[model samples]
Target: MMGVVLVAGALQHARVHAQAAGFPDFTTIVEKAEPAVVNIRTTAKVSARSGPQGQDPYEMFRHFFGPDFQPPGGRQGPQQNPRNNKPRAEPEERSVPRGVGSGFFISEDGYLLTNHHVVEGATDIFVTLTDSREFKAKVIGSDKRTDVALLKVEAKGMAFLPIGSAKLLKKGQWVMAIGSPFGLESTVTSGIVSALGRETGDYLPFIQTDVAVNPGNSGGPLLNLKGEVVGINAQIVSRSGGFMGISLAIPIEEAMSVVDQLRASGSVVRGRIGVQIGEVSKDVAQAIGLPKAEGALVGGVEPDAPADKAGVLPGDVITKFGDKPITRWSDLPRLVGETKPGTTSTLEVWRKGKPLTLKVTVAELKADKTAAVEPTPPKVVETVTTVLGMEIVPVKEDVQKKLRIKGGVQVTAVQAPASTAGVAEGDIILAVNDTDITSPTQFVKVVAGLDQARPVGLMVRTGEQTRWVAVRTEK
Candidate 1:
């Protein structure tokens, strides 16, 4: 009887040890980090009588159509009642919940960090801690480009998470998130770092994780195994407006940089070199005598801009920005944007089958728009020209002078093909299929000669941005 009891005790002990070895306990980390996590709620005043029917536009369509009806490209359509033309009665004004998100305290004196989108345009901001303490928060500063905002509350002696280095984060390492997902306060989820340096946004290279981050998890803390904050839970790639096993967090290093700027100033100032760039295609790389398909291929250069002044031409492929390599096209934007304005930086580019370095003085990125200049025209001229559902006119001398451009064609009207291709009025046509459009006649002629079966690429300058648009020819 004693031997049998001893064997049973040993078996039970072995089972307990095996369970401990298989599943690591996370209760200690959660208990330590939950106090710093916060739930944020915002209120905004929205116009009760908006749109043609004097009813909530989104509600009218959604409620009437059973909530599944969506227009092309997910844009809301006109909410007009065919049978009833009279305006529906609605309240004059009301305050509604604008958004719900999560944040974390960064200092003991009540300084916190959250996503800028969480409190953007909110009339009232309220923050609640894990200990049931609530306070109204003041928005110190927010940077929309980085999607980071610094906030301050009136409370004191708050719990804060220690900052960890995101640069040293590796894949397949354990990580956890603490947030109020779906209004569930202090929800803790654990997962491994799926990947790092994910390019999902224009400015940030996000830290990708498998943590179950949901809608209300935005602006929360992504903690390491040591209870240190590694990143800020920002965005998740989902189709159903819920977590789909892929979540992205803004790296702590990038967030701290923005936080420092916000603490010092009300806005962020980033450097820019006036040039439109795209990824170097494999075919283009081979054609241009490149060793491999890499770097940012300059598509267009703004006149009198930093890149233009530094002799950075359109055909130059930027291989390196300063000491950092441009392995992908997205790397150039992040590197250049992080630099300060008026700072001179060296750019190493591949040009004409050789590597060349150019020194460029960075310019402060502003809200101003850059106009397109006329390129050198083709030698041959074709007689038969079609407008392709568009009416255009050559840029006048005064307009060209105001736009700071030599010459280009301006769009006056748009029809089916042009409208379907997103060609709106007030757009300027710079080039068509590698041929520079010097006049409206040349644009029409180029469109007429384009192959109807293949797509036609047009370099369009719309307001402040320039990009290539592929328009399908009319059947």
Candidate 2:
């Protein structure tokens, strides 16, 4: 009887312990994490609508109603309301609220993180903490490609959450988010990580979750049970402008790297090898002798670029960069973009049904390196070749002078990919992949030299404005 009682007691204790271990209580986490979360508000400048072209109210009334329409007060402006005997208010212009988002302190000195879109073009920014303390914040820098932004508030000894790695996170792991959803400050929501390495952006492998993130939660922190921030809540997959179980967050590792860059130089600089890459289709993979479909398919290598100089050829599928696996085409971009320029990275490539290793010194993207300048005309035109299904012709001197452009190519005809890419007649090609088009022949050669399996960026000038169009090519 004594042995039976002892056994029953031990079993009950074990059951209680199992229950405690299986479900973690987030009360402690909430207490520690809530103080670090902040609500962000921004304002933008806007011009007010002009009342009427003419100052005279009677003239404006006559122009709108009729030639002989009478004014309300007999040739005067709006009259007083008869019921209240009060003058009516006129519409006035002012700066208005632009956006609302959430952010969290990353350092005790008040450095914070948020989404770039939340603060882009904002004229004024304000942040509010859990204790109802508000501070005007400055935008340190923003990287649009990664959708990450850094901000600094004028405060010291601020509460901050410890950073954790999203790489350590697993699917079905419990996580929580603290944010301001639709302006509800200090709101908390919990869920399990739905997935990781989600290909949502070319430069980010997002951490997907089912947390009830909404509009104002754009820049909040996604925390683990330990109260450490693993990701920055960013995007939501929704059709009705509300959270419908799918939310995405930027991994903390990537966010921290971007924050460091933004803090140092007001902008993020990313490494580029100047090769256009596509996905390795199953058929292509099989044809190339791979056991399974994987890796980034190199389609176009820009002339004189780092990849071209490093012997990275067209049709070579990149299996790995440095030691990171390129399981998806998008993974290559994120890896390359995170790497520092001038770093000699080893690339494992699959070519001719065999593996080849190549060394590529990464180069900084031109847009991030220097401010854009107008191109000077070249004295001569190069040989002609065709790609992207566009007939190229040298721009007439008269047309070039009239358009204020030194040199360009005029599109004579569009077919196949060009037609589908919205290229039209009379559209002047200003540049190809950031290289200034000196002449029609040069433009043709540039296009022809491009691999047909890649997308070509064409700077098309239509009328007085110019825009970039990525022309798709047949793979």
List the pairs of residues colliding in candidate 1: none
Summarize candidate 2's per-residue lDDT along 1-475 as a digit string, tens digits. 9999999999878777866889666778999999999999887664443322212323322322335444444555434444655322754545666668899999999899998878877778999998999999999999888778999999999999899989999999999999987689999999999999898544578999998887778889999988999999888776543468998999999889888889999898889998777666664464346556888877556668888898886556789999998898888877898889999999998765578899999999765322232433333353433557876667878878876677878776668788777777667777776467897667767777866665676656665445445676665
The alpha-carbon deviation from the true structure for residue 468 of candidate 1, after best TM-score superposition, in angstroms, is: 12
TM-score of each: 0.69, 0.66
List pairs with backbone clashes in candidate 2. none
Stretches of candidate 2 off by over 4 Å are: 1-21, 50-93, 368-475
Output the TM-score of candidate 1. 0.69
Superposed on all Cα atoms, the candidates' RMSDs to the truth, in angstroms, are 9.5, 13.3
* lDDT by residue for model 1 (211-251), tens: 99876788999999889999999877765544678989999
